[model samples]
Target chain A: MIFIKILSILVMLFYALGSAGVFWGIPAERYKILVLGKFFTWTGFALHTLLIISIILLNGADDLSRGYFMQLLAWCILLAYFIGWRLLKSGFLSLTASPLALLLFILALKVDKVQIEMPGTLKELFIALHIGPMYTSLGLLTLAFGAALLFLHMDRKIKSKTRLTEFDRGLPALGTYDRINHLAVVFGFPLYTLGIAAGFIWAPLTWGREGGILGSWDPKEIFSVFVWFLYASTFYLRILRGWRGRKAALLILFIFGISAFSLLGVNLFMPTHHSFGSLATFTA
Target chain B: MNKHICLVGLNHRTAGVEIREAFALADAGLLENGLLPVGAHLKKDLPIKEALVLSTCNRVEILLAGREEKLEELAIRSWAAARNRQPEELAPFVYVHNDAEAVKHLFAVASSLDSMVLGEPQILGQIKDAYKDALRAGSTRFILNALLHRAFFVAKRVRSETGVASSAVSVSYAAVELAKRIFGDMPSCKAMLIGAGEMAELAATHLMNAGIKSILVANRTHERALELASRYHGLAVPFADLFAQLPEVDIVISSTGAPEAVIRAKDMAGVMRRRRNRPMFFIDIAVPRDVDPDVNTLDNIYLYDIDDLKEVVEENLTQRREEAVKALAIVEEETLNFCKWLESTELQPTIVDLIRRSEAIVREEWTRTSKRLRLSEKDTRALELMLGAIVKKINHDPINFLKNRFEEEKDGQYAGLLRLVFNLDKKELCPRRTREHGSEEAPPPLGPPDGGMIPPRRTPEPAAAFFNRIKEGSK
Candidate 1:
């Protein structure tokens, strides 16, 4: 436990340092600092991976906590960023990914470590499928949100014909941001739908007929359905309707906000079957 | 004999364009033939060992490594004679930098810090081409080869470590930069030239060089449009088809002599709808403004008139000037490093002589003493080994002391003193003579100067002051 605590702190420190390096490097136009930032990020990621493996080994899959899931989500976000970075060849994504990951990791540390129980092996697999795909989709959406923000900023700058700041100069082209947004939405929406469908299937089997697909009208379930609809519409508009640029970017940002609230806020604050402690007690 | 590195040249600051044009070596078929017209003259008439002639529109510099005596006067006279001019006429316009100053000048030139448009990138490529020409002509040997390679390294260092050359300094380049900001991949983007104007043509050329897929030309005169279109291998469309072509291209450059705006906001709105709101860049270089200022109000439309591009150019030029200061510092640091290497080359003969003389004395003493004792073969071998170790031990301190002195003494005073103290320079005791026996030994081969690669002997105060004096005098 103490080792886990120390490892988490180290992960946070490296992430904080990496984000600081990236932020400082962009405006200062220093390549060495950017390289140092990348080194720190990779080191932190390696340590974070070790921490995740250790947590699963110690607690076992059946007794995982909400805090552990939060850490997993942060890891997934960083994973998404690395994949995007490789495909797009844009360092600008780190400008958003680094800070967002650091923030999420810190938030994960603050969350209470109350382990939830799962009854059987098949149910545990179902839960993993439900949560894993959902978290990964959210992670990609978070990046899409970041790309949208940059797109709007660059769009306004070009439209206004304003002199670009040093930070602005380091940003990728507006088209690059648009492409990232398009790719994120196209991939994210399908995984999100898969996650929701998996939850619908798992809830009936675990809670019986009393907890239907809607999970007895739980706020988490209602919000998940709402976010899925929003995501699907965005996906449809982007692919079939050829929606692009500012309007599409704005819609992606809106969907990401609601999805984040549904995933985290409803589970922690609202009374729902998806709340880890409540679900564990109800099962007992 | 010591070889002096010298640079004789005239730039925009020192001479008018007419004088620069007259002295341009590139025009005399130097680059094509890969021969310097003055190379043979300098090598035969003077003691020049290596020569490289760099001629660009803004400057022409002749870099030479040769005998220090009369180097400046003879190099200038030969360069003038090659151009069919008198030495007196060229002397007033030309400035000379020797030794360390020459290294600094070459580095500054390669880094584009000395360019007329500060931080322009063309100068480095021009230098590389000039070096290649000199190599093909067999004029650049040892000293010039090392120096040119060092200059290239310094240029690369400056470019990567500083923000110099990161921004556009001209109107057309600024337009292209803005287009790049809007559209990430230039090769996929198409451009349209709305009129056959000079500024529009320049912008089209810049876009083409940036790898835009294709260009469309529209002009009031169909022949003029065809002429411009054929030059770029683009299709020429009629003036009436301008609105039709607007929806096709991502970039539009307009400099037509129309009395009113050629592209209006409402028209752009329809075009944007047809283009599915894809981004469009309009560069208006016309006096009356070919693009409506209100066109900027439309979604996904970026419009920049002549004044806005001028502002961007002005801002970038200021940014480049600031970056040039950092670049100059890098050049100064690298220049000092190269000079240290040059000074070590001067210390090479003395260091070699010291080791060789010590070994000779040790061997002679061992041979004479062992003959009287009549030692066995094994004992003789052991004793010779001990004597060899003693010779190494004896030469250690002198070598270290000379190296230490070399770092402090820039004029080779300690090397000369070491020679005198050890009597290492006597004709009979000289290692070069004994090793070669009968054949005439060539001058020391100026190989790579990796040996004795120490920090510079003194601070850059004198070099900086000299640079400032040149800058002031040129003005």
Candidate 2:
């Protein structure tokens, strides 16, 4: 429990430092230490997942229906942290991913940790198919964001064409980062497409036939497709036409911004059952 | 002591490409014939004591390690003879140092601080190669073994902790990267490697590796070009035919050892006509580059020399300055640790001597007392325990203090007092003074300079010692 509290505090402080632009004159060992610290945090996340499951078992199956959103988001965040941990270990994505995971964990903590028991079979399957892919997509996009930031930093440093500061050594090469960002989009697309498909399939059962298909055309779903289009365009333009370096870097960044909007943004603005309580306005 | 290091010879720095080539020994073939003179001189006149010879196009440095008195010019005279150069001719340019200064020189050399171009890491690799060659030649002696290992440690500290090895440190490599942008893939292009200087090879090697198809080695001396060209498997084009070679070459990486720009604007303007509409990349890695400055203005040609490439290298270096500061802290930490280890070596003998003397005194006194006063077995056992505790208490501080003395050589006077009290044998505790006739007339060249380690300065508090007297100033 103490370790869990410490990790939460560390994650908050680390993100706050990043947001404040406090990075400078960092040692070679700095990220090596961060990687080790992040590994311990994943362990705490596992323990937290165990605690939530115990609470869900104590509650009856009927409660699983009403309170399942919190449970879905929690498991999604936990999976996000685990995969983020792997990416950081590979040195593909680093300090940037931690902040996003930290924010999601905080969001989970805000929601009820009192998880309810299992739902009806059809409902459970639908929930798993829809929520699991969305979380997986979120994690991949987080990795893309990390790569994109490094690419921007490296590009800025090169364009300035002045003396490199300590920051240059801390950065992966511009070409290397650009390639990683491209990879994220390549990997994230299929998973997100499947999630959208699953959401549509589960749509008829929850909202019912013609009405259900109408709910499936909710703004969140529309924007998800829009994001998919943006990323697919980036991949096509880059691979087929050799649109690389800075031009390619800027495009990926544009795609990442659209993705964040669809993940946290559409959730805030769009209406229908998929919307958060604060953002429920269905005009059509 | 065997702490001093002596280095003498010519490099790309002190002498031009001509002198470097004249003294260059590129093979073991030269070691037998050219180095024979050195062996004979060592046998007839003076022993080298300990020496290692490093000959590369950039520089030829002969590092000699020995007692300061034994490692003088006379010891290094044969090393000069190996190059077939007069002792005095090389002596004026030769630099010598002892102990700490010597270690600093080795560190600087390996870390590229002493390079013609700062932060070029090629020198460290060259030094390592030289050490290996020395071992193979059986030229390494006792002092050299220690110095070589210490040199590597110092280099590791400098590189890991300093910005010495970070960023685009080498101008030549920077030239190539920038050229890559201008030419894209250069496999379809032709490159001319001007000058056969060692530094030129580094730049040319990088360019050739980057997919430049035909690499032609051109120089003032045809023989030097022939020799160098054969090694890189490039064709040796004569200096007079430079204009002819210019027509076909797309990229010209010149590190010609000329003292001035050999390729004038008139020549470049003439060559540009032949280049047609093709984009030609000319990197003048040479200090006084072969290509003229105005050649950069020529259409369809990008000309960058040492001065221009340094600007890019400097820019990248500036970005690494923060990392450099962090590295310096690491260096300081490592230096202190090494200094501690050095002092510990000094302390070990003193500590061992003190323990031996203390135990002997205890044993002698205990036997005399037990014979006369102790009658019962229980009394004898009690007496032995009492004597042992007394010895332990008495011996504790002095031994511990000697070990602590390594922390800035504190209580410099305490060592003598402890030795006197314990009656520790002087011969065993201190370094045995040896007759250093290993080489004569080669006493360490002591130059008058105040370049010793800077003692930690005291920024006096305005309160003037807070609660204590300002003894020296008041007096």
lDDT against the true structure, per candidate, is 0.79, 0.58
Q: Provide the global lDDT of candidate 1 against the true structure.
A: 0.79
Residues A1-284 of candidate 2: C-alpha lDDT, one tens digit per residue: 45545544554454434322312213344554554545544554555465456545655444543223543454454465356445433332435544454554455444323332322347656555666666666666666666666655654544434444444544444444555556666666666777778766755544455755444477776776787788678767666644555556677778768866765566545564544443221110
> Candidate 2 chain B — worst ten consecutive residues by lDDT sum?
B450-459
Please, what's the RMSD in Å of model 2? 12.5
Best by DockQ: 1
Which residue pairs does candidate 1 place in steric collision? Answer: none
RMSD of each: 8.2, 12.5
DockQ of each: 0.63, 0.14
Q: Please write out the lDDT profile of model 1 over residues B13-39, one tens digit for every residue.
A: 999999998887885654235334333
Q: Give the range of the ten consecutive residues with the poorest summed lDDT in model 1 chain B.
A: B454-463
Task: Quote the positional error of residue B443 for candidate 1 in Å.
Answer: 17
